[model samples]
Target: MQITKCLHTALLVADLARAEHFYGTVLDLPKAERPLNFLGAWYQVEDYQIHLIVAESVPADLVNSEKLGRNRHLAFSVTDLAAAKDQLLVHGCSIQMSASGRPALFTQDPDGNVIELGETQLA
Candidate 1:
């Protein structure tokens, strides 16, 4: 089977409130309505979505970038890289710049899930 698009990615989180605050307040992603009996919440990530599900344990390998060069991070394209970087820092989020000469930076969520922010427009 061929995949046309990514509808969503499920991220297991330990704290729902903190994860919600990070995606909603810090990253400015709008919350999506999830059905009743669903054990998770959804957030609009640019054109796609991210699902935050409560989990008692997460694979440490998925959250560890030092071992794999951050190959498993979700990336977003923003209009302004500097502004996004500043906003993340204001929220007490540390950023790691991408060394490929592109306008990109990496940060983590409360659950240690890696997020990459890239500049959408060229200077």
Candidate 2:
């Protein structure tokens, strides 16, 4: 059988409030209605969704410390890379520019979950 599109990405967060601030406020992702009876928050981005599940502890192991972009990360396209970088800095989020010299950057949430933001053209 053929595989279907990705429904969502689930991330385990130690602190739900902090994770909400990062994904909901900082990144400006719209909150989605979570019907499940669990400690978590959901954010909607276009057709995709980000599910933040509350956990006792979050894993902070980085496979590639020097180049976070090379590790396991979720990537999203942005209109302006510079503005995105500025926004992340203003929120006190650390960032790492793509080593490949592309218009993109890697940053981590409060739980140390890597997220890549890349520039894309508006069609």
Candidate 3:
């Protein structure tokens, strides 16, 4: 069997409410069906879906600070990198550029999960 595509990506979040605000309200992902006992929410973006799972509690080390450059990150391809950066900034996200001269914006959800917004050149 051949691989088709990614169905969803699950992120462990400290606060389910915050994740819902960011991914649902900010990113504007449509609502997806979620299990009542799941303790988190799911958002749909085009074909793929993002599932935010609520963790036990917020880590003491990560409290009061935004997660930056952690080992894990999710990248979303956009049509306009600059526009995406501006939109993210408008939503109170901290945008950072990559060192490779390519346009990129970095932001974290309330749970300190890093979300990357970038674009690929069309052929």
Q: RMSDs, each prediction?
A: 2.3, 0.8, 3.6
Please identify model 3 stretches exceeding 4 Å from their true place.
58-70, 121-123
User: Residue 107's C-alpha lDDT in candidate 1?
Assistant: 88
Please give, for residues 87-120, the per-residue lDDT of candidate 2 as tens digits.
9999999999999999999999999899999999
Output the better candidate (1/3) by TM-score: 1
Candidate 3 CA-lDDT value: 0.75
How many clashes in each candidate?
0, 0, 0
Ranking by lDDT: 2, 1, 3
Segments of candidate 2 deviating more than 4 angstroms: none
Instruction: Give the per-residue lDDT of model 3 (tens digit) for 2-38.
Output: 9989999988888777778888877767889887686
lDDT comparing candidate 1 with the true structure: 0.84
The TM-score measured for candidate 2 stands at: 0.97
- What TM-score would each prediction reach against the true structure? 0.87, 0.97, 0.79
The weakest ten consecutive residues by lDDT in model 3 span: 62-71
Off by over 4 Å in 1: 62-69
Cα deviation in Å at residue 36, candidate 1? 3.9
lDDT of 3 at 5: 97
Lowest-sum lDDT 10-residue window in model 2: 57-66
Task: Please state the error at residue 91 of candidate 1 in Å.
Answer: 0.6
- For candidate 3, what is the total of clashing residue pairs? 0
True-structure lDDT of candidate 2: 0.95
